[model samples]
Target: MSHLQAHAQSATKSAVRPEHGNDVSPHRFCVAPMLDWTDRHERYFLRLLSRHARLYTEMVTTGALLHGDVKRHLQFNAAEHPVALQLGGSEPDALAHCAELAEKWGYDEINLNVGCPSDRVQSGKFGACLMAEPELVADCVRAMRAATAVPVTVKSRIGIDDKDSDEFLQRFVAVVADAGCRTFIVHARIAVLQGLSPKQNRDIPPLNYPRVQRLKQRFPELQIIINGGINTLAQAQALTDGSDGIALDGVMMGREAYHNPYTLAHADQQLFAEDSAVPSRADVMAAYLPYVEAQLAQGTLLQHMTRHILGLYKGQNGGRLFRRHLSENAFRKNAGISVLKDACALADTHASLPPHEQPDDNLRNHA
Candidate 1:
C-alpha cells in the first residue's frame, strides 16, 4: 500500500471538531467559487438575488496570499457576509498561514480546492491530483483547522483519472475527516487528468451522483454538499429531497448560476424558506446600480463588473437589448452609470408592452 493508503487505514475516525464549539455555517444553497466568474462583483450581484444563499470567492492560491498583495486578494464588500474563501495549495504550513489570513479578513469559512482539473493547478501539486495523497491533504486540513476558528472545509472530486473508484474516494474522505474536516463538497464526477481540457473535465465525464449518496450513507455525521450538473431549481429541489428522509445538506450551482444568474431569484424562498419577499429581476439590477456607481467613482473599469451581469435578463423580454447596451458601451472611456439605466429602460419597456406589440428583438434570439 502507498504511504497515504497505509496512513488512512491506521488513522482513527472521530467526530469532527467545530471551530469555537459551533457548527459550520449553513450552506444549503451556494454559488460555486468559479475562477473568473465568481469574483467579488459577481458575488455581490448574486447576493442581491438571494439573501440566504452562501457565496464564495474565486479560489485564491497560497502564492497570491503569502507573497502577493494581500489586501487586493482578501478585500470584499461588507454586504457580502456569510462568504467563504476558497484556497488552492498543498503545503501544510502555507495553507495554515492562508487560513489565518482568511479568518483575519473576516471570511466565514475556508475551503481547500482539490477538485480543479486544470494543468495550472496540477503544476502546483494541488487540486484533483491530491486525491492520491490523502495523507498530505489530511496534514493540510489539520494545520488549517489549528490556525483559525473559522470552519475549514474541503471541495474535492469523487476521483481522479484511473483512480475513479468508490474505494479510493472513501479512503480519501476517511483520512481528511479524521483530520477534523467535517464539511465536504463533492463534485460528483471523475476528473480525467490527462486527455481532456478543464472545460471538458466539467462536462465530458459522466456524473455519478449515487456514489455521493452512498458517501452520505457511510458518513452520516459529515455535512455533504453535492455539486456537478445541477443547473435548474427543479433539479436542485428533487436532488435535495432524496428518497425517504435521506438527503444531502446542500446543493451548489456553478455555470447555471453564472450563465443564467436570474435562476437564483427563487433560491431564498424555495431553499432557505425565507419569509421576505423576493426581488424581481429588474429590481435586483436597480439595487445593484448604486454599488456600480460607487465602484465607478473608485476608477474600476465598468466592464470588470458589467461583464458578469450580461446574463441577468436571460429568458426575459428585451434581455438582448439590456445585454447589447452594456456589451457595446460599458468599456468606453468614463462610461458612467447612465449605460445601466438606459439598458434597464429597454427591458422595462418590454415588460410593459403586450406580447404581440413588443418590437422584434432579432438580437434576442442570437443572445
Candidate 2:
C-alpha cells in the first residue's frame, strides 16, 4: 500500500465515532459560505462526514429572498444543524427581511458576505466593496441582528486594493463591532477589487495570518474565526492556537473532502475528538446512494452528485480507478447505486497506495 493510502486507512479507522453517542457538542470549526458549491445536497454530504463541524449555505441575495421562493432557497436537511445562512445585500431592510426568513427556516446563524470580490457582486453594490463602506455594513448587521434572535455575523476580507493595511482592518472591525456583531469571520487577505476575478481574489492576495491574529488579540471579546488558505487538519489546528475557530471551504471542505475524504474522516478524530466516529468511505457512499437515487428519480444529473465524490478515494491504491469509474459510469443511461458500488470497489482496491500519490490540492478556491 502507498503511504497516502495507508494514512487514509489509518485516519479513517481512527476517526470513527460510535453509533450510540449523541451528546457530542458542535464546534465552531466550519465550512465557509461557498457560492453555488454548498447547496443543500452538498451540505448534506458534508454533514455525513463531520457531524460536529458547522456548515454554511451558499450566499443568497436579498433580492432573491424578497422576490424569489424563500423556502426553496433556504430549506435544508434536518441533519445539517448548526448551519449558517449567508446573505448578500447592502440594504438594511432587505437584509433584515431576509434574516427573518432565514430564522423561520431554522438556520442557526446569519452571515453577511463582505469578502466576495466578484464583478457581479460588485455590480450589485455588495461583497468586498462593502469594506470601503463600513457604516453600511454596520447598519446591515444592526438590522439583521434586530430582525432575528439568532446571531448575525460578518465575513470580510482584511482590506481591499489601496485599503490593504492594518488600520483599514482595525477601523472596519471597530465599526462593525459598534453595531453589535460579536462574531467576525475574517478571510485573512486583501481583496483586489478592480482587476482580479473573485477566484483570483481568493488566491492572488497574500494571506496575512499575523494580522488576523492581531485582530483577535485586539478584540479579545469577539468570537473571531480565521479563514483563507487553510487546507490540512494541521493548518486548521495551527490557526485555532490563536483564533476561536477556523473556516475552510474549497480547500478542506469541497476539494479536499472530494479528493481525500479520509482527511474529513480524520478531522472527526483529530479536531472534534468528542464525536470522532466517522463512517468509512464505503459506508458514506452507501448511505448517500439512496439520496443519489432519489435525485436521479427527480431527473437530477448524476454529475451533480458524483462531482462531490470525485475525490473520495484520492491517495488510495485505486484512487484513479475509482475516479475514472465514477466519472465514466455515473452519467450512463440507467446509472444507480451500482455505479457507486463499482467506484467503492475501485477505492477499496487502491486503498494501499502511498500518501505522496494522493491528489490533495492545498489551495482552496471558493469563487
Give the best candidate by TM-score.
1
Q: Model 1 segments beyond 4 Å from truth? A: 1-25, 362-367
After superposition, which runs of candidate 2 have C-alpha atoms over 4 Å from their true positions? 1-27, 243-259, 352-367
Give the per-residue lDDT digits (tens) of candidate 1, residues 1-367.
4322222223213212112113323777888999988988998788777756688999999999999999999998756666899999999999999999998888889999999999999999999999999999999999999999999999999999999888999999999999999999999999999999999999999999989988888998998998999998777776677742367878899999999998887986677665666677777777778778888899888889999999988877778788888888888988889888888888887866777876766654422
Model 2 C-alpha lDDT versus the unseen true structure? 0.75
Q: Least accurate stretch of 10 residues (summed lDDT) in model 2?
A: 246-255
Alpha-carbon RMSD, each predicted model: 10.1, 7.7
* Residue range 279-311, candidate 2, lDDT tens digits: 677767666776677777888777778877777
Single out the weakest 10-residue window by summed lDDT for candidate 1: 12-21
Clashes of 1: 0
lDDT of 1 at 121: 94
